[model samples]
Target chain A: MSDIFERIREKFPEYFRSSHSNFGDDTILIKPEGLLPVMGYLKDEEGFNVLMDLTCVDYYGEEERFEVVYHLYDLTEKKRLRVKVRLREEEPVVESLSHMWKNANWYEREVWDMFGVKFLNHPNLKRILMYEEFEGHPLRKDYPLRKRQPRVGPLN
Target chain B: MGVKRVVTGVFGEEGFITTKLDSMVGWARKYSLFVYPFVTACCGMEYMSVSCAHYDLDRFGAALPRFSPRQADLLMVVGTISHKIAPVLLRVYEQMTEPKWVIAFGTCTCTGGFYDNYATVQGIDTILPVDVYIPGCPPRPETVLDGIMKLQEKIQNSKQEY
Candidate 1:
């Protein structure tokens, strides 16, 4: 743990921010609005070139409704950093990281499609995996497993 | 070994069909079919095998996987499509030139299967038009070929109807 911490502390000082925790893994909470700049520095300065995955979890039972996560990997250093930004149920918005990584385009769209976390600068944030007519975000705890919304009117 | 057998295998002769191929599509339906596999998970691996040298889907004109949806006649949805991936699948289906068909390629895409827990769509049919439903945890290559044959038959029969 100390070694990994030192590695980040030594290599990429500009990208590293304050809250480094030991929560199951080396996780950090970044300011929700500052995701773009921080992510940019990670891509531009550090060698963490790949945004391997982007996902969101609904912490429904808890006070926080959502926790959006981005897993960034440095191919050269073989290091991984998990950046997380929590969001309230309503008014959930975060700056997009689409500019830094092309892969983020599809992944961000997916998170938006499933969890409804609005990515502010995402080029195309429309639903990727569901019909435009789907009633509500199914990943949310409120949605039923077997949704029985009736087919209304003409099938378009 | 001979030109005759190659012709029959390539163009699909009426009486020269293998028993598995016979069961896959009707005598006349097995020819001139194109498939586009919408693969996302482990099942996609099986799909590749069926299309590759081993299983040899080329015998029935389905070995070529079309990149452009415009050229494809069939859509083989071959894995667990999350709520995020489902729309993209539908868009691909919509993008396809008409007279199209769909094979719900495995238990996951056909129905959520073991993933009936959370955020998984029970069946892709709820989202798209499905012609044939193939079942297996991750169906074997043989089973997928069988599903393709069935889809070909469905397509042939539908053509005859019109």
Candidate 2:
């Protein structure tokens, strides 16, 4: 483990769960509540200034069915970090990082649109890719691949 | 030339020739088609090739592409129509002037191609009446020209509204 990872582990001992470094990429599994503070620390103290991506994975049939993943980058050190938060399928809610990173607004909206994971404080958490009248989230594991919704014209 | 020669022959060198007004109008409409290209995907590249100097859609009187629907008589849907854009496509079709015809310009617009999913519309015909369907993933310029010729024939045969 790198010095920065050791510093993070020491700083947030209670929130730190487990971490793995595979193929030269470091990923940390943190508690859901620790997202905002840990991300803030990474930004203000550790210099991870860029939030590269935020997305979710659905491990269907698991106890914690949804795993929200965040990829952060440090511009100065030229390093990357992956943070994950596991949430139960029944209530897949996470803290919005829009306050820290401006682009998180749309990222969170996309996550909500695709995976149906809610960000508690997202400014506008509506469908970013799909139309308003679209019924179900199409990216979920159970969503039938070829299932089509009613079209928008008289011919339909 | 065929219709005019027949009329002139029967009329015996008369200055004027008489024919059905519908045929006259169809002939005129087919020769001066103003097309609106509703381009939304990779097929637009093929559409460009067909319209440019190499293929020359000008020979077929479909070289002029009107950006607005009001001035166009032919609506060439040139790509995959997703569910989100379906209403917008319908609105454009509705906004076009009377005597308008639709051409599904590629396989995506004709039958949704291979994207049989929740997002893509199965075919544009489900939303708007289609006159000609050009079947290609992104059809060759020759194929597109053939489709245009087919559309021209259809236009020349159909009854005119005005």
Candidate 3:
């Protein structure tokens, strides 16, 4: 696993910001532009078979505000990798992984619904958990907890 | 005539049953509650346990769980009601026939539990008028049974307008 991690680091020096093995897991931070290509490489050549989870973390009041995290697992090798991509606060857009792993579709939608991060070229990029009329992403740091957007009528 | 004669004979006997027609109707309605289990989250497990034997919700006369809202006389909104699903819940509640009752089962249904977020509704009472609130994170079967008894009491006390 360490050898593979080293090899990946050596192969894609331009794509990687930093990578390390800690807590018995290998983690790699990839730039937004290199996200698709890196994930493609990991999926095709490196044999990360399953995209276990795709989620977002909001680092509010920061220049690069969001981190989209992807947990990939190699079923045959019985190994795991954590891939991350930071996004600017202004436009947090990342390439959709729906084409690589079918399950990324809903996971991406959930991320989008919660954090308001956009997934480019997603087949159906719409709110999966929230209603269409819901204003402001709730998971964003600026979103007030008490604020409510009511779409339904009051029962008379 | 035979039934009336028997009733007269029974009525003539001292300390025999005597009650108004409305009271009798209320008594019947109280016992024969056809509950619609609107189960959504973790509280559904507790609901399942309550309905099953040992806990035996049938003993209270609300054993029959009607899936269709039209057939249900009681709506047991079990688990969390999210803002997105609130409309669906309201629609189900509306479909129930008149003289209907609602028991908000579990803390989530009663007061949104710990999920004080954007998605989860604060409480079902914001939409539907809840009759009995079974208070617990995922209340014990005993608590649920107690809630049913409380609802039964409410049913018995209700004025039969329709």
Alpha-carbon local distance difference test for all models: 0.74, 0.88, 0.87
Model 1, C-alpha of B40: deviation from truth (Å): 8.9
Task: After superposing candidate 2 on the true structure, give the runs of residues whose Cα lies further than 4 Å from its correct spot.
Answer: A153-156, B6-20
Q: For candidate 2, lDDT tens digit of each residue in B1-162?
A: 114634356557765756778888887888788999999999999999999999999998889999999999899999999988998999999999998999998999998888977888889989889999999999999999998888888877877787
Better of 1 and 3 by DockQ: 3
* Model 3 regions more than 4 Å off: A153-156, B1-17
Query: How badly does each model clash, as a count of residue pairs?
Result: 5, 0, 0
Estimate the Cα RMSD of every predicted model relative to the unseen true structure.
9.2, 2.7, 3.6
Compute the interface RMSD for each candidate structure.
7.2, 2.6, 3.5
Per-residue accuracy of model 3 over B13-67 as CA lDDT, tens digit each: 6434556666677788888999999999999999999999989999999999999
Interface RMSD of structure candidate 3 (Å): 3.5
Per-prediction TM-score to the true structure, in the order listed: 0.55, 0.91, 0.91
Q: Which should have the higher lDDT, number 2 or number 3?
A: 2
Error of 1 at B114 (Å): 4.2
lDDT of 1 at A26: 62
